[model samples]
Structures are given as structure tokens and as C-alpha cells.
Target: MSSSEVHLRSTIGGVSVEGQLHTLSVWFILALRLMMGLAFLQAGLSKLLGGEFNAAGYLANQPASNGSPLADLFVAMSEMPLFMEFVNVAVPWGQLCIGLGLLVGCLTRLAAFWGAFMMVLFYFGNWDVAHGYINGDFAYMLVFLSVAAFGAGRILGLDATIEQYDVGGQPLVERYPWTRYLLG
Candidate 1:
């Protein structure tokens, strides 16, 4: 109810959810975006520059020790030479692209979606339930999802400008509503 707080309410599947956010909450949201961006960027760069980032041994071995349910699937993937080749390239490159997209706030939702997806696989792959089912991977997954849902890109990000770009005399988002899924 305070002037410095913003109220938010939504109804999903007939369930109403509501909350209040302090005006300064946007800064925290931006911080999450930047932090994840840096983490992923550094990871990708290290993998690409390491020149010995073979995933086969890790994929075939790590999951089993951790008792991951997908351990068998990972092992199978490692066995397939072609798939392993693709994985070697995709993992590092995907992280780099996702990092850049999030850092610059360009195609942020797309980046965040992929980031969340990668986290999902990592959550299963790492499969550490030592203290509990919750872990860093699971937390990162939520962070990615929250970034997408909050449209964090529009806050001091290129997405704000990209959305307002003129297209046939109309803002890009207004012209093509579907772009909302990718841009913000």
C-alpha cells in the first residue's frame, strides 16, 4: 500500500496469486541477469579455450556416481560418436550465445529459456541430494525462469530499445505480437 511498493496480481489456472515488490526490486532483478550472464560467459570461454573439453568421459562417468536417473541415457549418448561430437560443440557454444544474449538483453527470453533448459539437464546430471533435492543447479534454473517471466531485459537492457523499434510505422512488438516471446 505504500507509494514505494508496487502491487502485482495474477490468476493462473483459476488460482490467484498476488504480491508486492519494493520499487528498488528492479535493481535486484537486473543483478540476477548480470550475474548469470557473467557466470555462463566465463564457463563457456573456459571450455572453449581449454582445448581439451572432451565430454565423453564425463558424460559416461559422472552421472552414475551421483545416482542420476538419466545416467543410462547419458552413457548411451557418450557411446554414440556422432552425438558426442555434437555435444562437444553445442554445450560450449550454447553457453556462449546464451551468455551474450542475456548480457546485452537481446532475445533475453530465448536465452533464459535455453539457460533454464540447460540447468534442468545439469540438475539431473549432477544429481546431488546430499542435504536435499535442492541444489545450485536447481536454484539457477529458477533464476533463469524468473528472468524470463519478469522480462528483465526491458530494464536498462537493449530489449527496451528493440521492442520499440519502428517497423512499418509501428513498434516491432506491436507489429508482431509473437516477438514478445523472444525479445522480452
Candidate 2:
């Protein structure tokens, strides 16, 4: 109830929720955004610079060995020459674009969405349920979701400036309200 705290209330799926956030929560949220940004940026940079990254071997072997339920689908995908070609290029480039978007906080929600998607694939590919259903990939997927939900891009990010840019004499988001889904 302090003046510095933020009171939040909302309802989703007929369920009501309420909470309060400490002023310092913003800094932690910012930290999560920056941490994921840096990690992904570095990963993408190394993958691209490392040269000729291929997913065929991983697709054919890793998922099966890890006992993923999607192992058959992964193997089928690897056997497709055209699909493999696309995967070889898409994985690295997608990572690079996603990383850059997040690092700069431009098209952040879009980037986070893709990041979470990639994590979903990874979670299945790396499939280790021996310790439980949760793993690093699953955790990273949640982190990406949290970042998007909290609109972390607005915290020291380009999305804030982009959203405020004048479009037809009105702020971009104000003019096109739908952009709220993509930006902060």
C-alpha cells in the first residue's frame, strides 16, 4: 500500500487475480530481459560465425536418442532434402534475427514469440524427462513468455521510442492500436 508500489488486478478465463509489485520489480524485469538478450545474441553470433551449421544430424539422431515424442516427425523432416536445406539456413539466420531484435528491443514481442517457439522445439529435441518434465529449454521458453507479457521492451528499449514515433500526427501505437500486440 505504499505510494511506490504498483497495484495490479485483472481477470482471464473467468478467473480474477490481483497483485502488487515493488518499485524494484522493474529493475529485475529489466535484468531478465537483458540477460536473455545477451545470451541469445551471443549464441546467434557464435552459430553464424562458426560456419555451416547443420540440423540434419541433430534432427535425425538427437530427438530419437532423447526419446522425444516428435522423434519420428523430426526424422522425417531430416530426410527431406529441401526441408533440410531450409533448416540449415533458417536455424542460424532465425537465431541471428531474433537475437538482434531482442538485444535492441525492436520488434521485441515478435522476437520473443519466435524465441519461445525455438525453445519449444529444443525442449522436445533435448527431451530429458528422467528428472521431470521441466528442463533448461522449458525454463527459457517461460522466460521468453514472461518477457513478452511484461512488455520488457519498454524498459530501456527501442520499442518505447518506436511506439511514440509520429504517424500521421499521432503516436504510432495510438494511430494503430493493433500494434500494441507487437510492440510495448
* Per-model TM-score on C-alpha atoms: 0.96, 0.96
Over 38-81, each residue of candidate 2 has an lDDT whose tens digit, in order, gives 88888877878998788999999999998999999999999999
Q: Rate the local accuracy (lDDT) of all candidates.
A: 0.93, 0.89
In every candidate, how many clashes are there? 0, 0
State the lDDT of candidate 1 residue by residue for 11-49, as single tens digits.
999999999999899999999998898889998999999
RMSD of each predicted structure? 1.0, 1.1
Against the true structure, candidate 2 reaches a TM-score of 0.96
Model 2 Cα shift for residue 28 (angstroms):
1.2
Give lDDT: candidate 2, residue 160.
Answer: 98
What is the model-wide C-alpha lDDT for candidate 1? 0.93
